[model samples]
Target: MAKKPLSAWPWENLGSFKYAMYGPLAANVMYSWIYEDSYKHPWCVHILIICALRGFMHQLWNSYNNMLFLGNCRIKQQGVEFKQIDNEWDWDNFILLQGLLATMACLMFPSMDDEFPIWNTKGFITLMLLHVMVSEPLYYWMHRFFHGRYLFTHYHSLHHSSSVPHPFTAGHATFLEHLILSMVIGIPIMGSILMGSGSTSMIYGYVLGFDFMRCMGHSNVEVIHGAIFNKLPFLRYLIYTPTYHSLHHSDMGTNFCLFMPLFDAMWNTLNRNSWQLHNKITSNSGENGRVPDFVFLAHIVDVMSAMHIPFVNRSFASIPFSTRMFLLPFWPVTLMILLMMWAWSKTFLHTFYNLQGRLYQTWVVPRFGFQYFLPFAADGINKKIEEAILKADRMGVKVISLAALNKNEALNGGGTMFVNKHPQLKVRVCHGNTLTAAVIVNEILKDVKEVFLTGSTSKLGRAIALYLCRRRIRVLMLTSSTERFQKIQKEAPADTQNYLVHVTKYQAAQNCKTWIAGKWITPWEQSWAPSGTHFHQFVVPPILASRRDCTYGDLAAMRLPEDVEGLGSCEYKLERGVVHACHAGGAVHQLEGWPHHEIGPIDVDRIDLVWEAALKHGFRPVFQP
Candidate 1:
């Protein structure tokens, strides 16, 4: 239950219980006289108009940005937020009610001893600007904390689900997220009021300007002219562009400023891509009908196995994002980062990517971060996955990646059963396992060259085996199927066959310095190998790595927006950690045309060649930490 508001607060004097339940409706009564022309109709009717205008404004911005892309650079090929099922409700309902409720909160705000319009009083303008200054560091660190492992899985990732953010997405956060962000603005307002230097007009100005800039930040469309940046370079220091904030979302670190770049520049937390993406977009040849087709795939948690219980020692469905937000004020649960890494990983339901028009859908899978990992959930999980893929295929999807457990095959309890189920399915199916395997090899080879490749006959493992051979790295292929194992060896080609050797036992997995395995008919119960050889486990039911000895990561490539490590903040590297992909497929697909990748089949060699092309284009793992 919500705490009872003071009687002095709006409508509480009318007996708190009756009116508390209808507070926002009460605001219509309180503020109705202020808008006499609109009073003839119900408040709901007026709100409908407001929402319509808001939506229209969003469309206008999206259209304007598409045009501006001719002369300006975009942070990504797509900046338009694809409205999703969950987000659609929030956009249509939650925001409307929240805005109506804020009418009363706005009316209750206090005034300072002296007041003046921003234009009339330099003091007011100075104080308004100071609000950003005061809020910047707090917002930065708070944002940093949110990115850390525990809070991110619980709270922050909600906002990030919309990878290609829209203007309204600034408020797509959980309740606790809203509360902390409110402090960024509140502290400055309260500070000025306490110090006796604040004014009503200044307070309103700050609030209005603060929100205006945030909308601009997420707009994905930069309205500011390039001439201003060129002629008055100093102005860039005063405020950040939308490209600045987009990099923060895509890169997951740096550019942690609120409405201004002053603190980010001073603290050395800014990344270089702000200008790179901007210049790259601006340098476009301004060709009509040449804009890229922006398509995205969305998934919550992958269906993977789990080794531990989440909060309350219960299945993840019991603890949801809404419940977590409600509990946030009372308990942050930050301690989980140290004592409960696996539990934390399975705690939150993270919708992995963005959802847009006709593409917004979810399977019958329960809302659990790690539900599919439960002992016997394979059949039900695979059924839902097949249905999702079949639907996407029927709808003319270009390519679909059944992320996490969805990629797992049901035979022998795990592998790619979907691709074979309907080989004729027109839509290209990608587990991203191929590209994922490619990137994992790069990360693993960073320290150790020799390793055991389990599931070497599987599609992903085969690609890894071939790629490793191409690099001349030694591989001990571990597989139980003799025919499949020998096939890999026989087809290994002259150059790679010398580096590849096959064995049919799990025990052989530990002989090498590192162990990289795919989903197996039998599970490797321990988090790490008993021999203490570093294990790079790359399957659903991800191996929880405490130290670096057991490392687990997803298998997809993204073009990082900035250099996360050099951005100079421990919070980001601490929160979500870092995963790198070659992004060769993404860049190559971008060049081929819009709607991203082609509709037909794509191969491992094609993606690997893109990796080579990416290197030639000066692309590398941009996130260091």
Candidate 2:
């Protein structure tokens, strides 16, 4: 590791408030437009707009490159980790700083007069010419110079910190490096303006194009088709691909050119295997794509959560899921994404991680939480789930764990539908409900002899009731179905069957301080419980904290193994590295190499077994405190 220099931006510690750096420049532009009536001199306003455009363009690339469906095109197979995400979180800081500097430069240069038009072909050509002559060679040398011992150790090393480059990784640099970059980028634009060839469109085009190219190079995903280089041959020297720049990060000695490989070739600094490696990745996207040891079949929660996936926004997804005011404006865009998914999308890989040397991935079905209840949407959702299972089976995946709504009993019978349909599946289909049951039951304190249980007719509920009754603990089963209650009661021995008491109303559990709610309880129902009663729930969208005195535990979840790697994003509302019990259950099954499918009803005898297995594999329960 190189020693970091004290080149941090003054505003670096300000966090998101660092965006306020744009306030002075934006106010100046707005003042000129309103009070000063300087309509012709729109240069200041254009600077602000260009900054906004570049920021948007950079985010688009970031989102697209991290998309799991497009993973095959990725230059690096390993996933981005939390450390890299933290390093790049402030990537947009450069945009604000550069915008400020550019605005000041416009004020300084008298040649940048108030006479601006919509477009200028001459200005566009001039900017390109300047970029090739000045920006290209100057940046190539500066980039190479930074790689030298002193500069690399003190400055350029920050930019190379991301082993797997993301789009924002391009902007992640020391203050001194960005200052140099601003000068290199500004020269071409300023040259066009100084030569009287500058226009509004040319400035926008050049700056946005510059950002686009930078993002493309750092995107990790190789989007440029091999045929493009093959057809032209000369384009290889004229342009650089994602693979070209990625090679620079990995090897650090070659492919130093900014946007064009022409300079690298001239200096003999280009990586010789760049083209061959690019083709290998792009061609690996078909039937013989890479396989994983375990697959977690996940689904969308709702409209608000659709954009919370790792590919959509790394910063947003890295934290616990929440509704952001900034994201509200993008709701229409999210709705469009949903419509597209409803129309053509299928099960696609959303993210993945490594645990104990095994490759584990999360493949998401294109259905939202509400869709799973639409009755009409059941078959469609199930079809997507089945397709994902069959695909995993074909890919030689060891285990496929159905998550959340994907394993709903009414929708797919807890993944039993797929396993029974394809009995010869080499890949085991798992609902992970056994571990879910284990987590819920284990949540009960050992000394508690009596408790209230809701949704007692459900699979997990039945398992919990049977398990508790065998321990001589009284489980007051809250259910309207006597037949369902009797069936579960019979599963226990006659000596303990009396411990499984069925209750028709919430009033029956008034004296019990421990409440296990598998179903959503209304305030009136919750009120029936005495004060200080704790609510441990497995209900989706865990019931709200309605009573101040009563405690509420989050949904059943387990912290992933401490050895888990590349877990960059949070799993829903749970804390980082913590996943729903069902997801962990699948992981344990894969680690233990359980031969049989864990679908349908959970076996009561296996509850303790799964719990012990999870602990053995380093999975811990989410501590309540």
lDDT of 2 by residue, 163-253 (tens): 7888999999988888888888899888888888888888788788889999999987888888888889999999899988998988889
- In the order shown, what is each candidate's alpha-carbon RMSD? 17.9, 2.0
Clashes of each: 13, 0
> How many residue pairs clash in model 1?
13
TM-score of model 2 (CA atoms): 0.96
lDDT of each: 0.50, 0.87
lDDT of 2 at 257: 95
Evaluated at residue 279, the lDDT of candidate 1 is: 51
- State residue 152's C-alpha deviation in candidate 1, in Å: 33
Off by over 4 Å in 2: 1-6, 29-41, 110-113, 287-289
Output the number of the TM-score-best candidate: 2
